[model samples]
Target: MAKGIRFHYLHRDSGNYKKFGHRDFSNPNNLTVEEITQRIRQALIDTEFFYPEKVGIPKFLFHRYGDDFSWYEFESVEEIQTHYLHESIEGFIAKLLRDG
Candidate 1:
């Protein structure tokens, strides 16, 4: 099986970046029409897991399979599979269950 990918989901508690601070979505360069649409679509979804009061949205920061410094924002983990040979943690578990 291929190696799994590493990613960090950014929330309020994450370290502040130079421009966007802890919220990458706040950056104009990072915001997209798709993201705006997604926000509205997921607005009813609970965010208490990452925020105290459904305040912040979960944003994925994925890095290249082996390189730590190559982090990039992606809409979803499944999207990463289209570009890299790495798999998500959920995918890893599913494969294990099927192959075992």
Candidate 2:
């Protein structure tokens, strides 16, 4: 099964795009990836199913030329492209901003 996760996104003034993921906290406001492994110290006090211990950003994403820049799991890449064909330029802008 595909693992799905929601991210925290910070928008821009032009409403062009919003950046998300661990980058929002660690990177230079760019793309970043974090991997966490859960650990429970005291099962009695901690009711959470999982408690993550490690938190670090991916090295490559913030780089100008990185794999993530070329390809990312954008929520709505296709819909924005379609709007360019069927509507005005603003319509394309509208669709692109809807991405997460």
List, residue by residue over 3-91, the lDDT tens digit for candidate 1: 22332232222233311212222221323444433442343224212221233223335322332322222223212112334333433
Alpha-carbon runs more than 4 Å astray in model 1: 13-48, 51-75, 78-88, 91-100
In angstroms, give how far residue 74 of model 2 lies from its true place: 17
lDDT for each residue of candidate 2 in 3-65, tens digit (9 for 90 to 100)? 222222221223234444322111212221222111111121132211111112232234333
Instruction: Output the number of the lDDT-best candidate.
Output: 1
Task: Kindly give the number of clashing pairs for every candidate.
Answer: 0, 0
Clashing pairs in 1: none
Q: What is the lDDT of residue 4 in candidate 2?
A: 24
**What value does the lDDT take at residue 31 in candidate 2?**
22
RMSD of model 2 against the true structure:
18.4
Predicted structure with the largest TM-score when compared to the true one: 1
Q: Each prediction's Cα lDDT score?
A: 0.29, 0.23
